[model samples]
Structure formats: C-alpha cells, structure tokens
Target: MSTLAGEFKSAYSAGSGDALAAVFTPIGTQNKPYRLQSFYDFTNAASLQKDLSFALFHGKSLKVPRAEQTAWVDIFAAYWEAVGELLKYEQDWPGASLVAIFTAWKKVANALIRGYSSSAGIPAWTLPCLYTVGKYLRTFAINADIKAAPQGASSFGFQDDVAADIEKNAHLEEAARIINRMFTLCLSDRAPMEESRKWGIYQTTNLIFKTYFRINSVGLTKNLLRAINAQSADLPPLEAFPKSHIVTFEYYVGVIHFLDENYAEVREDAFFRVIGLTQLMQAEKHLATAWSMCHRGASKNRELILTYLIPCHLVTTHTLPSDQLLAPFPRLEKLFRPLSNCIRKGDLVGFDKAMSAGEEEFVKRRIYLPLERGRDIALRNLFRKVFIVGGFEEAKEGQTSLRRTRVPVVEFAAALRIGTHATGRTRIDMDEVECLLSNLIYKGLMKGYIARERGIVVLSKNNSAFPGTGV
Candidate 1:
C-alpha cells in the first residue's frame, strides 16, 4: 500500500499522465504497473477502502501538493466510489442496477474533467484519462439501456412510430449530452498551445459523433461539423493530431454526406480520378491512409473503411470491387462478390437474387440504398453489350466502314430478356426497354438519342459513348 501511494505521488508530481491514467484504466495490460486488481480485491470492501485511503490521504506516503489537493482528492474519491459500485454490479448483488453503475462512472468522468479544467498546472497529456473515463461512461450507458429494454424487443427498430424504442435509448442520448460537454470544454480552452485542452477536441467530437450515429440522430453530426468549422481558425491542422483522431472524424463526415446522397460531384486530375462528391473523395483518401498506416493491426477498422468504400466506389464510379480487393476479407467477399459479378455481367436476375440474399446485412450497414442504384449500371452494361454485338456497318464501295452506332430496340429488348432470365412464355416489352434506355441517356451514363417512332437508339458516334466506361 505504501509503495503504491509513493508511486502515485511520484507520477503525479512528475506530471506523468500516462502513468496516472493507467491507475484508473479498468482493463489490465501486461505492462501496466497498476491494475485495479493490484490495488484492492473487489470482494473485500474494507480492503478497497483501506487501499484507497492510503493512496489519497496517507499524508506521509501520498504527499499531494496543497494547491492541487482538492482536485486530486475529488478525482480519487469519485473513482473509488465507482469501483465500489462496479463490484456490486459485477457480483449481481441485489439492487445493483446498470444505471447506478453508469451514474457512478459518470461522476468519475465529471470529476476528472473538472480537475483537468480547473487545475493551474495540469498537463494536457492527462486529457486522455478524461477520454478513457468518458468512453467507459458511454459503454455502461449503452449496457444500461440494453438492460432496461423489454425482453425480446428488437433494439434496432428505432423509428418515429415506436415511442418505446426511442424511450429505451434515452441513456444513450444522455451519454451524448455529457460527451458534448466534454467536446465544449475542449473546444473552449484558451490555454497555451502546448498545454491547451483544445488538443482533445477531435477526440471528444469523434465520441459524440459515434454516440449520435448509434442513436440514429445522424443529422446532429452536421451541428458538430459546423461547430468545428466555426473554430477552424483556432484549432490546429487536422494532420497535427494522431492518425486515429483524423481517420474517425473523416469517416463520420464521409458517411454523413454519403447518407445525404451527395455524391454528385466528380473530379479528374493527372494523379487521380475521383468520381464522387468532394467530401466523399476526401473521406476515401483518409480511409485509405488509415488502411496503409495501420496495416499490421486495426483489422476491424480497415474492414469498416472497406464496408463504406465499396458502396461509395460502386455508386459514384460505376466500378466493381476486384477479387483481389476482397481477398483478405472473406465475409465481404461473400457479401459483395456476387453483386460485382452480376453487375459486370449485366445479369439482372442474378443481381436481384444476390441483393435479396444480402439485403438484411446491407440495410443493417446502411449501404443498401446506394448499392441498389447499381441496377442502373447493370442495365447500362447490358445495353453496351447490345452495341458490341451489333458489330460494324457494311462499307459502301467508295467509303470506309463505320462502327454500328444505331441499335434496334428489339435487339436491346432481347438482351434485357436474357439479363432478366425471362421464360419462353414471357413477353419482352420494347416500351419498357426504351424507357430504361432513355433514363440512361438522361443520366449521361450513355450519350445517345432515342427514336421512338423508329424503335432504335442512335448512340453518339464520338469515342466516348459510355462516359465512365472506357468504351
């Protein structure tokens, strides 16, 4: 006990925030010198009180400076109170509720934030301790919400009609409110650059962004962006922060625009060709950077990046993911490879089957609508094949031969029947095929003029008939 107190005092005096944070971090690591288990056995309340007292108030051994003693005492007191409640909750003692557990942890977070904000000489490095406490507060709140929900209810069914679903997620909403406080604190700091709380702004913003997404209040994310933009002149460049912070911030921003269906802008340059909105392209760049930077670890994060990237690529660029691209992620391969095949082959029936098979998973990931739009690309590919099969026109005696740019509606109708796998008894509707062709032309996917009376499509003879495709 004396040795632990001595170590804590030394770390506090030296402003070794990493060491201080590890003391409160719940999970144990092989290299962490002070695990919760090392300090007190949860089974013994007396032992916990004794150890906590020695660390916080044993004047001879702990020796906290007088100026910062109140903040120090309050921080440790809240942490020990939380630890006591956690013990009861873990043991399933009577009346020990998840809400109580979350509340206790929230107090610890509030104490840490207060200390970090009000203390005169607190190092900015201690900010991560606040983040760690805030993170667990969110976790416990989520768990509490799950525990509070009715048995057998689908928590994912969060719609305006279901008042119960909204009520059940109240804890998550509360967590978002507290996290926003942390964000405001970070953003409002006016300290010197090296010791300022502003360094923690993105980290807190990322947490609130995640919470907002979980509660299905994605529109609130825009408020966060606007807040950040308002203070852009004061904040450091995004690149100055850790890669984890920048990557998460970019990812949420990307998904926000993605959900808004704002992928209309496209840009081409010597080094790269981006066929999506400016925000999405920027997101892809950062996600790609995250993938390359953390190649050896963060496998789940890399997979998440691909989860949105694949659909973004398909919708904006009319391109399919390559086999090599999905090779490392077998689950993604199963989910997307069939769609890629169907789109490339213009097999509409097969595409529909693949979509049905993965509909639930796609919808759960929020990529279903964007991917559903790939049907148009599949239709475009089918008609492109009709032009290919039409071949070249016959040459006149004194003239050169030209590629067949005018295709009969009947021929396109035949290809559509094959793509849709129509039965022999099924009638192929030329009008419907013409309607599809007209949409492609209107969307600029194809450069063509439709002749309704002549029942033919006169595609542009210019080299770029299909705008995105290298046809």
Candidate 2:
C-alpha cells in the first residue's frame, strides 16, 4: 500500500502523464506499470476504499500539493470507485450490470477532464489518461448492449432490435455523447504547440470513430473529418504524432473512402509516385503502406489490412498474391487464393463458385461488392487471350506488318463459352457477348470500340489493348 502510494505521488509530483496513466490503466494493457488489480483487492469494496483513500489522502508518506489536492483527490477517488464497480461487473455480481459500471467510470472520466481543463499548469500531459477512461466507457457500453439482448440472438437480429428500438443500446449512444465531449475538449484547446491538448485530437476521434462504426453510424465519421479539417491549420502535422495514432487514423480514413466507393482518392493519398494508376491500384498502395507499418506487431491489424488489400489488388492490377504474401495469413489465403486463381485463369464459373463459398465472410467484412467487381477483370483477361490468338494480319510488300486489332464478335462468344465451361451442346449468344464487351470498354478495362454493324471489336492500337497491362 505504501509503495503504491509512493509511486502515485512520485508520478503525480513529477507531472508525468504517461506514468500516471499507467497507474490508472487496467490490467492486460501493454506496458502499463501499476494496474488497479495490483493494488486493490477488488472482491472487497471496503478494503478497496481504505487502500485507495490511504494511497491518495491519509498516508504519512503521501503529500499532495495544497493547490492541486482537491482535483487530484477527486479524480483518483472516482477512478478507484469505478474500478471497484468494474471488478464486480466482471465477476457478474448480483445487481452489478455494465450500465452501472459505465455510469461509475463516466464520473471518473469527467473528473479527470474537469481537472485538466481547470488546472492550467502541467495537466495537459495527462490527456492520454482521459483517452484511456473514455475508451473503456465506450467498451463497456457495447458490452452492456450485447448483454441486454436476448440469449443466443444473431448479430443481424440484434441489429434489427437496435433499429426497432433506439433505446435498446442507449448506453452505447450515451458513451458516444461523452466521447464527443472529449473530442470537443481536445479540439478546442488553444494552448501552445508543445503543451496543447490538441495532441489528443486523433486519439479521441479514433475512439468515436470506433463507437460510430460499432453502432452502424458510419456517416457520422464524415462530420468528424469536417471538424478536423476546419482545425487542420492550427493542429500539428499527422506525421508528428505517434505511429500508432497515425496508423489507426489512416486506416479509418481509408475505410471511409473505400465504403464511399472513392477508391481513386484512397489510392491518391497512398503514394505520389503512382499518380495515374487505377483506382484500386492506388487503394492497394495505401492499404499496403498501412500493412507494412504495423506488420511487425499486432497480427489483427495486419490481417485487416490484407483483407482489404487482396481484393483491391485483384480488381485493379489483374494479379494474384504470391504464396509468400499469403503464407502468414491462412484465413486470408483461404478467403482469397481461390478467387485469385479463378480471376487469373478467366474461369468465370470457378469465380462464381469461389465467391459463393466465401460470401458469408466477405459480406461480414464488408468487402463483397468490391471483390465482386473482379469478374470484369476476369472477362478482360479472357478477351485478351482471344485477341492474342487472332494474331497479326498478313502484310503486303512496301507495307509495315501490323497486329490484327479487329476481332469478330463470334471469337468473344467462343471464349465466353470456354471460360464459363459450357457444354458442347450449349449455344453462346452474340448479343450478350457484345453487352459484356461494352461493359469492359466503359470501365476502361479494355481499350476498344465495338462496331455492332460489323459484329467486331476494334481495339485501340495506339496503346496496349488493355489499359493497365501491356498486352
């Protein structure tokens, strides 16, 4: 008890926010020095209060500064009180619900925020402690909502319940409101660059971004972007923040654009070197960077980056992931490798089968629509083969030999039959083949003009037959 009190006093007196944050941080978080579990006997609230009070107020060795005494005591008291409730909730004690625990923690977070805002000296550094508190408030609210649902309810059923009753997840909604307050507090800070609470902006935004996403309120993310953009001139550069913050912010922003179907923008922001690349090509670069940045740690983050990257790579570059790339993530390989092979071989029938096999997972990850677009690329590859087989026209003397650019529509119809694995008795339709070719042209996957009257596709000889690929 004395040692914990000494450490807390030492951290508080030195104005080391990081150390103080660790003191209040829960167990299981990385590198946190003093977990609440280490000091308080959570099973007994009376003993917990006595130890917390002795640590904060009554100990002979503990000496809180007079000017800061009130705020410090209030903050620590609320924090331990909340921790006591959290322990009860975790053990599923009678009458101890997530809602009650969340309500307790909110007071702790509010007390810290109040102290930070009211005390002008060195409390700015403790802003991360505020983030830790707000993060759990959101977490507990989510768990509370899950607990409120009927036993064995499907995720879709819970979603339907939420839609039918806005109050079903009221705790989560309330958590969001408090996190927004945290966001506003961080954004509105006018302190000097070095001492500013503005440094906490992205962390707070990331928390709210998570909350909004969990509650199926993705459109709200745009308002967050707008608010940040309005204050960008006054804020620090994104690169200046910790890599963890930068990586997470970029990830959410990337997903936002991806969900809006703005693949080009996602790629444009990835790297300046590949400016004119296809939309998904750029998007893959962006996602690849995110993957590389976090590849050394956090397997979950790496998996998420690759989950989106593999589909983008297929649709834009007309390529498949090598074994080396997919080797580290077996689930991703299982989800994508078959689709990759099917697209590469122009096996439309196999592609449909692969999609069906992984439909549940793809939809769950929200990558179904983007991945479904790979069919067009498969069609493009199939037609490229047809063009290759058509070969060059024979040249007359004094005339330069040129490759044949005009392909009969019958040729595409035949390729479609083979790609689809149609039986010999199955008849192919020329009109449907024309419709397919038109779609390829419109999407720039193929560079050609369809001459409906002549029943042929006139490829553009000026550039490669396919836009991105040389062939």
Candidate 3:
C-alpha cells in the first residue's frame, strides 16, 4: 500500500495522470497483501496534508477550538486538489469513474462534517466547514449540468445516472439530505445556544439552502424551520449574535415565512436591531423596510422608516443632521410622510392616497404585498387620531365634570374620502367605514362604539383613546 501511495504521489506531483491511474488499478486476488483502496483511502490517510491546496474561491475562517481544526481544513484543501486533478483527466476517465468520484467525495465530506457537528454540537467550526461544502456542491451542480426547474415544479426534472424517467434529480436530493443533516445539529441540546453560535449556523445553512433552492428544493425550508422552532426554547438571546447576522437571518427567514403565506410569523420576526444598518446599502435597507411594512411590524413600520430607511436614503447615518435628517430621501418623504401623519392624526383618506402614489415604486421593489398589509395599521392610527381631534369636551350633569365627545359616523367617513379624488376615485362607502371602525374597536385601537340609532361614534373618556400608549 505504501509503495503504491509513493508511486501515486510522485505521478500526481509530476502531473502524470496515466501513472496515477495505474497506481489505483485494482489487483484482486485472495493472496494479495491488502485490498487496493482508492480515493477513500487517500482521504482517510495523513498523506492528505501533502496533497492539500486551497481553492481559488475561499470560505470564511473563524477562531474556533475544535480538535484537528487544521486537519479538517487540510482535508478540504485536499478534496479540492483531487477535484482539480480529476477535471484534467475528466475527458479520459470512464463515466463510471466520474460518478464514483462525485459520490465518494460528497459522501465522505458530508459524513466528516456531520460527525464533527454531531459530536461537539458546536457551530463555531462546523459552520465554516458547511460554507465550503456548500460552495463545493454549487460547483458540483454546475459541472454535472444539473438544471433547476421553476420553484414549484413538484418534481425536479433532472435525474441520476439511472435510466428510469420517474426518478427525481439525484444531485438535488443528495444536497438537501446533507443540508438537513447539519441543520438538525443546530437544534441539538449541546449546540451552543449563544446568539453568535446560532448566527453562524443560520448563515451557513442559508447559503446551503440557496444552492439547494436553485434546483427546486425549497420545500425543505418549512421542514427545517419547524425543527428549529421546535427547539426555540433552547436557543439563546438574538442580541448575542453580531447585529449583522441578526439582520441577515431576519431578512431571509422573514422572506421564507412570507413565501409560505405565514403573514403573522413574518410580521412578528420583523424586529431588527439598529446596529446592522451600516452593513447594508440604501437599496438593501429599503427592501428590508418594505418587507417590514407587510404586517406593520407591530406598528413599528413608521419607526423603521424613520430610524433606518430614511437615514439610509437621505444621508448615511454618518452625515445625518441632528435637524431634519430626511432631507435626502425627499421622494420617500413625499410617499410616507403623509401616511405617517395620517397614522398619527387619524386621517384615513390621506393615508389611502399616500399608499396609492407609492404603489408603483413598492411593486417595483417587490414589497407591495407586505406594504398592503399596512392598511390595518393606518386604520388603527386614523381611529386614534379622529377620537382625539373630534371628541368634544362636554360637561355631564350627573358625573363629576365628565368630558364627553360625540361625533357622527358620516363625519368620520368624510375624512376617509379626503385623498381619493386625486386618484380619480369615488368616496368610500359608509358600510366600509363602519366595518373598518368595527375592526379598530375590536383591535383596541380606541375606546368607542357606534350608536347605530343616531349613526354616531361615542368615545369613552376614562383614559386615552389609543390603547397601550400610557401617559
């Protein structure tokens, strides 16, 4: 075995493919000194150190203390080297050899990574290795001529070497299997629940998922999220992760939930730390804020726009004036300022116009659906504003100077019709206005009720009309 290894090493160094092939040739006999092994033997042996070389594209490295960290990196390096050499001989190698090579490297590398993560349950080193594996899989898919069908094709059009037409794409299936294996580790008990640790895991997993998604393997995202959520109690505080990871994970996960039509989940997870804003460009922040608008993000859409998106669009956070920071994003101001004011002032009609004017831009940015959901928030704001502005300060005879306010529902409906004319739209229906008020009351946006006989809204004065804004 040592003699053959020596001959293969010399040939590989001298670029002698024929000689290396001859070295790996199986000589089967009962009396043979030992069974001839191939790439499998090369990978498991210490000689991998000598054969290793870094690839052109790089994977991130981190300060981690896993055993044989250098050895693992070297193993990856050697795998790339073997892949490079095989490419040179690809035209000459038999078809069986090509498939065998792909199968052996993929299987061995995946098992090695899964072993480390499973054993230590630490994402520190395991996460970095996963990126390299993901990169390799991407390369493998391209080289194999694997084509990704449209996202919801139900069946991957590509197939394995098998002649059967009914089989799914072998490459996609294998990659997904490997990804899920590592993903399950993130939910394990000892898997370091710190934010930074999980951040690494999520980022690397997203990268792998991106590759898999190209081949129509996105259905697995829901499955993977279910596993992670099942273990959410075991996860750490998100603040422990660097702000950058928090932003990225939230964006990706939110989008997945959005795609899944899980609107509430998307909204709940839209809370973003302000620290990561510098890491993204203005357009990127714009897109994220647009996504947040979908569910009003607990009514923080206004705050997100004010604190992050406005600063990004107008001047960077660095140049933001203590006075009127939104000078640069004038167009954004035109679109959202009225909406914000309407939200604050209970001007539903104006809010509707502002939303209409920005619809084109929002659609162009692909945030229309999410932003549309902001209507509920606008209604909430409008209701609060109307009760405050229109409520009368009347003295009740029997009560200790009770301040009573009563306004007709028709007056409320008129305010909702304010900006519609600009868009060539007609006045909003009275029933629609009543229905919206019903929702506002139901959602605790105000302490009020419709006096159906008189067609008026009577608001309570014991506390502020808006709920949760304690004075």
Taking all chains together, the TM-score of candidate 3 against the true structure is 0.49
Stretches of candidate 1 exceeding 4 Å from the true structure: 1-7, 10-14, 28-65, 119-121, 153-167, 262-296, 396-400, 422-425
- For model 3, residues 295-386, the per-residue Cα lDDT tens digits are 53333333333433432332122121232533444655565566556555545466667778887655433345444445556666555555
RMSD of each: 5.2, 5.3, 14.0
Residue-wise lDDT of candidate 1 within 1-471, one digit each (tens)?
343455567777678876776667655467644445444443254465445654566666545555456676567667767766776777788999889988888888887777767753455767777778878877888778878887764553422111224356888788888888889889988888888889999988988887888777888989989999999999999999998888777766767766655324322332222334444555566555655655457666667778878887776577799988889888889989999998998888888889999998787777787788788888888888888878888988998877788888899898877776543425677778888898888667899898888988898774567887766
Q: What is the C-alpha lDDT of each candidate?
A: 0.74, 0.74, 0.49
| Pick by TM-score: 1 or 2, better one | 1
Best by TM-score: 1
**Decreasing TM-score order of the candidates:** 1, 2, 3
Q: Itemize residue pairs with steric clashes in candidate 2.
A: 267-282
TM-score for each predicted model, relative to the true structure: 0.86, 0.85, 0.49
lDDT of 3 at 284: 43
Q: In candidate 2, how many Å is residue 133 off?
A: 1.1
Minimal lDDT window, size 10, model 2: 157-166
